[model samples]
Target: MLYQEKHRPQLHFTPKENWINDPNGLVYYEGEYHLFYQRNPHSNDHADMHWGHATSTDLYHWEEHGIALAPDELGTIFSGSAVVDKNNTSGLFESASGGLVAIFTHDGESQQQSIAYSEDKGRTWIKYEGNPVIPNTKIKDFRDPKVSWHEDSKKWVMALACGDHIQFYNSPNLIDWTYLSSFGKEYPSHIGVWECPDLLYLPVEGSSKKEWVLIVSINADGPNGGSAVYYFTGSFDGKVFHPNEKPEDALKWADAGKDFYAAVSWDNTEDTYWIGWMSNWQYAGVMPVSPWRSAMSLARKISLYEKDGNLLLKQTPVIADNRKEAASYQDVTIQPDTAESYAISDTAQIDLRISEASSSTKWGVKFVTDQEEVFQLAIDTQENTYTFYRTEGMIDFSEEFPEEIKGTLNGLDVQNLTAIVDRSSVELFLNNGLTVSTNLIYPQGTVTQLEVFAVNDVLQIDNVSWTQLKSIWN
Candidate 1:
């Protein structure tokens, strides 16, 4: 298989090649952050899904490890969570073998939840001889177990993806689990089917409001395939999840992107950080001639804020911890009917803040080519919005192609727009990553020129920075 590496966001890890889906077993262990993903190691296709392991000291530079877990007689090593057993409460590890324990779904063709044990610092794992530690209970689609230590009750709590609901369970030693209750089903609009559920406590800033967020990914049939993260803000009462409202009243999407799915968080750290597979079920396994078919969004730092009587989750780029490489470009004043162009090197990240003087909205930045091809990010002053439009590149979709597909854009609010362009990908972070559009652009060569223009009226460009990124995978 061809392993073409690209310079991605700082501290956010991605695979060198092949398909990567679902952020599995994300946890901080032994002074390092370990992220395991669903990877098809032998090929770039989506078959033979196995768990590929990688660890990082600061969530930036990653060191690859041997395959963490593979499909045993089981169907596939599906999604799950991991935690550090500080007090050896799981009993899977001894005092001498003090490190971590991973609890994941062993989809044994029958598609049931099974447990495995790892004593050697999460390297090699042995299936719990008492396979299917949690009985299927005949739930049609029970998978993606997220386990956390419930300090309130002082016991282990886990959430499972049951069709249209999240089934709660409790375990004392991480081996035996008892069914608690189901969380969603009364409210039809809450979510159709809750896949990949994460329940955690996040400390609200400047307050003692330790809010519990129950995040679930929904797959609704349609163009979007209904992949989204809906969260309920409340307090967990150990034995049960008593939302302030009914289950239907607690659903809110974490992101408004077309590609975010199967997101899971690590419970080992204090920070509310999460990563999601950045592909959709509608387009999964359908990329053309791609050596790798999928990727995860840069790990996002999540926070809860009360807006308009509702708790809104704000997601920020977690790579800010390693942004020293970004440098400010020369400030350029924009004049009506005047456009400025800058020649870029191999790989670059450009950040710009647009301020409108009057009211005309047609301002934008264009990635220009000598052959007259252009990719544009345009602002609509009248609509108070911005859009990312692509007019070039070969995207061979099996179905009819649009002459131009507006990948993703957001309404202009307080936050500015940031664009990270590598050799093969263009990730546009709109409204400070509240919304994002990630697209693959297989440019034949280096993109050397970038132009900014005020399409209609005079616009003030506050700051622009272009930083050449160093490739770590090479």
Candidate 2:
């Protein structure tokens, strides 16, 4: 009865009650993937922050495990990272087998870094007596520490967001941290105070070498509007990060949509998987969802690839083995000014591939309800861009909700495309995940159909399939 609310997401993760934002302490340990988030247990609006916990063997179905970290004398638990301390590097475990160690921010008098250990697989936590391992040095916007084990120098690394730049530190035991270096003071794109900084090594698609990636989330100024993620690729010596490309050369955005923010990856996983709070700060508090005010974007498996001599990031959704196919089509052709329609459920995954397309082709897909409310995605071949429009539905709750979300195709040879559609969200992955867009919709009527229209040029589609996704919380 809890998740049966009108606009609850079936394919995404949402708290049963209260408000959640900025996923924290993401890690994979033993046989389960842990998702800890910033939660306000008392109300549907953000306040009284705590770290809420959940776990899943498969990324799709999750079991809530209640709160893991609460506000202590120092401060409220804020965004951070978790790791499996194998080899007992922190000397917290009695035996050689290390437990889970969380390095997070304590937002009290001034924001500072702290640590906690989970010996029972994150069920219970013990805050280190030595709180604020890395004390704040009077930085106004100091928070969100992302920590990981750096092997080359054989030291644990901490990437902390400090005002307009990211500060680096190293620790041998996750407790005593030493200052290493700082980056982003010369960075051209200082839109707002940086929050949620993550540093990791990502494997290049065609090469055996791995490159270091630093992700920074900024508030109030994004590619679209407010709260977006941007990343820089380069090399990280155990101490400092040197970008292969200058930060001022061109700013690379991780997600071009309005919703994706505070995206961080899970530690101790074979492949890097990421999740983000799927709401923009511009209109987050004013969203039309009840009971729970926020939901996360679908978990994206990320990797790096080279395109047109530029290294780019690709995000592919992890496919669940439990989805059931509802419909399939092959080699369907739509002439100019023609339209096709199909019945769909409230929660379904739509997979489509473009088999034949021309330079002048313009097409769009409309998710429609019987009440004539529509959310649309339009593709323009001439402009080499796609735009999302949600003007016809229940968008009056926030004036910022009706803005068009657009993304460039980068002259990509368009091929496979996918959309994960749920009761109140649509996540579109285009060109095999080269570009991803996420948006939240609150329609008065239930979405029951999908319509495709060719605005001008004829198009040939292939391997089209629709699969329904079961709700994790139902």
Candidate 3:
């Protein structure tokens, strides 16, 4: 079969070939950004796990660097983290802080965390002979070690997903670990076992206070089902993570979408940044994109915000909003129950501002080809919710993809909407960073036009502009 290059993502990070799942061992070294992932290099199916490698100078354009950590006598490589060993803490290299270190999980008889050091940046790695740094316990599910430096305690802290709650462990030399505490046993969304947990400390805006953000990804149990990313804002006292006080059963989600999962931050970055596997565990390898299976969401700059006395994490695209406008229209008024269509790029960024919205107004946008309607993003004022419906448009390789994904927000306050469309994904952000919806869909046919329409009531569009994005693979 001929490869459908049009279905390949242009701006997102995808492996040169084969299957990849979780984003692993992300770190910033000097000027280059390193992204290691859970990969199967031999085929487009999930097996023979290895840490596939890629490097980017600016985190926008990536260079595939083959595999970094392969399977050994212990087992195949799994999800973990990487760090720059400053001050020669691990004593793996002669130099002080320039040495690179990668901490990962080896899956054998049981899941165990191990350490590997690189003398020449992150290109080469040597596993610590004293392997299984954090030996396996009696638990069944234990993996994904996300490590960071805790200055107050003067030790390295690891946030790992065990079963339900993420456990905290303190390490002195990245080898020996002391179990501190575990969180999230019977609280919040315990629909499934947690995976890919990241603990982050964020400074509050214009305040002396700081809060710790823990990102947890769940599968089979999300707001939209299949897979999703959820988060909590609190303070970690180097021993235990104390989630901020909230009403009973109030759980916060990172991105209210089905696609984004196993997200983590970049180590040694001056500012907080993140990226996620743009796939759901439900249909990850089944999408059949051929040479490659999945891609990563665009890197996002993360910040903290206050809403209803709760500190929430807001994500905005790290890449600048610079693109060539293919077509644009401003303050276009839509008559009652009418539709409008315009030409657009296969990959584009769309901005929409709809004002004079009423309780009866039903406004939405659709991605379509001349022969088929690919996807639809519709807002229902009466329900005070936004829905992304793909039942009529998607090519379902499996029985996992959801027919519709809906998110509820203050629809009255929703005046601005930005949609970032790649060949196979759509990430929708509303009113700055209040709510985001990331969905993956494979249009059965070509997608070459954009359409906006209204139902039941007349609506006036304050502004509408779209720009075709350049391919990062170029």
Most accurate candidate by TM-score: 2
User: How does each model score on lDDT?
Assistant: 0.68, 0.87, 0.83
lDDT of 3 at 237: 84
- Please give the ranking of all candidate structures by TM-score, highest first, separated by commas: 2, 3, 1
Candidate 2 residue pairs that clash: none
Model 1: lDDT of residue 130: 75
Kindly list the per-residue Cα lDDT of model 1 for residues 37-76, writing each as its tens digit: 8888888777787889888776656787878888877678
Model 3, position 329: C-alpha lDDT score = 89
Q: C-alpha displacement of 191 in model 1, angstroms?
A: 8.9
User: Better model by TM-score, 1 or 2?
Assistant: 2
Off by over 4 Å in 3: 1-4, 204-209, 245-247, 320-322, 356-361, 410-412
**Candidate 3 lDDT tens digits, 257-318:** 88999999999998888899998888887885868889999898888877656676777875
- Output the worst ten-in-a-row residue range by lDDT, candidate 3: 354-363
Candidate with top lDDT is: 2
Tens-digit lDDT track of model 2 for 12-61: 88888889999999999989999999999999877888999999888878
TM-score of each: 0.85, 0.97, 0.94
Clashes of each: 3, 0, 0
